[model samples]
Target: MIIILLILSVIIGVFLGKYFGKSQSFAKNLLILSAGFLITVCVSEVFPEVYEAEDHNIGIWIIGGVLLQMILESLTKGFEHGHFHHHHEEKNILPIALMAGMFVHAFLEGIPLANITDVTSPYLLGIVFHNLPISFILGTFLLREKNNIFSWFIITLFALASPLGMVFGDYFNPEWQPYFLALVGGIFLHISSVIIFESNKNHKMDWQKLFLVIAGVGLALVNHLFHAHH
Candidate 1:
């Protein structure tokens, strides 16, 4: 059942991303929604439990993970921006580097899913929601570069990356789980924060955009609250 849900979520993410790619406004909205949802997931779902576990030096791992992503982004020259491929002309190394970093990040995220004792469904749902916008962003980039085959392959790989991580995580010792969780959480924070920050229109704040972010967070809160009460 869990495996099925994972596959379904990835499929949903791919299609939604493809659909949203056609509209800038809708894509922006989706990103904001994803941001809110990610923030909520981090705060309400991931943070509390991860902090409590305190199984490993999370702070350090988080910083390390963020640094890793920063380096990767620099190499990729902001491939996450979507629809912009001028950087692609610079070198082939950038795309390969970006994929490596993103793959590692996605796989680590899957590790936590395997660790989830309760609320597995909700967690997977949130992950799917989060990945959809990212998939769209990546897809847009691929389309712009006219690399259809590579784009599809990258998208498919992104979807499966997490599940693969979960498999690896399942074999890891319980004592080391906290460190992994913190690292993955940090990676998520970096990605989601970038999404929100980049999604901002101009340097000025937009109420509608802010609202979408809040809506995303609210969705996660609702799920968290339900879990808490239960």
Candidate 2:
């Protein structure tokens, strides 16, 4: 069920981006909203879970995740954050580097999902929602470059990257679970924070964007509380 949802989200993202990627504002708004939810879940839930493990070197692993994302972004041109601009539409060939970056990032996201196995786990939710916009942008990029059967084959492979990570995640040493969680948490932080803080030039969010952010944070709180109670 979770694998289906994960694949469906990216497929849906491709559909939306192919048709509606021109509306950059909607994409940005989605990023803001998901960013709000993702960062909150990271701080309020995943971070706590990792720190509870009491690993002295955990902080460095998280930092490594952050750094890893930075490197991936260089390859993706910020596709993971839904920040792909309109200026690059002229190039009509598939970008292999972009696909590679998102593939690895998504793969890493799946690793921690296996550790904290839950249908409504924030880790899973974050990756699913977070992938939406990036996949959307990827679709848009495909639309601009090569909206061919071959392109969708690439998308299908990209869609499977996360679930594949989850499948392989079981092979990881059980003791290392917390470290993986912290690492993915850091990746979530960097992606979502860039979306929120860099959305506006002056860094001032309007009422609507502000509300989207608040709603996302509230969502994380509710999810956190529900898990706590159950």
Candidate 3:
């Protein structure tokens, strides 16, 4: 069901990109909300889980994840955070590097999903919602490039990347779960922190955007509460 939801999000994003290309505000708000949600979940849920592990070296692993994402973004030009800038002349060329980076990032996010001993729904939900804007942004870029077959194929691959990651993650021995979770925590930290920090370029915080952040955090809190009572 999680795999199906992830794929469905990408499909929805592609559909929106094709038909609603002009809806930049919607896309922007979606990115903001999703980023906020991811950040909140990472702090309120994911980080605490990994930190509680017996391994004292988990912090180093999480930092490693952050640094890894930084390198990946160098190739992707920050695609995971909605940085889909492209030159008009270069638009004719496929963004092979960007796609490769996004695939690795997406695949790593699924590693923690395979060993969901506690409060895994938030992780799954966070990634699925997070992927929507990513797919939308990528879909818009691909459609603009005018390669119909290739665009569809790449989007399909992006949709499947997480599910494939889950399959691969299932093969890991249980002992390594903490390292993988901490790594994912770090990845989430970098992505979500970047999104929140870079959300406002004018240096003045937009009230609407702030609300989105609050709403995102509220969502994570609500989910935590709901699960805690049950």
Q: Which has the greatest TM-score? A: 2
Instruction: Give lDDT tens digits, candidate 2, residues 1-230.
Output: 88988999999888898899888888888888899999998998889988999888899888998999999988877777775785365453236776788789888888876766678887788888887887887788776556888788778878999999888888988788889888888899899888777756576658887898998898888988888887
Taking all chains together, each candidate's TM-score versus the true structure is 0.82, 0.93, 0.91
lDDT of each: 0.68, 0.83, 0.80
Q: Distance (Å) between predicted and true CA of 218, model 1?
A: 0.8
Candidate 2, after superposition: displacement of residue 48 in Å? 0.5
Winner on lDDT (2 vs 3):
2
What is the RMSD of candidate 2?
1.9
Among all windows of 10 consecutive residues in model 3, the one with the lowest summed lDDT is: 85-94
Better of 1 and 2 by TM-score: 2
- List ranges where model 2 is wrong by over 4 Å: 90-94, 202-205
Greater lDDT among 1 and 3 belongs to 3
Backbone clash count for every predicted candidate, in the order shown: 4, 0, 0
Residue lDDT tens for model 3, 1-230: 77888899898987777666557777777888888889878887788888778778789999999999999888777778766645324554346876788888889888777776443488888888798888888777777556488777778878988888888999999787778878888888898888778746668868898898788888877877776676
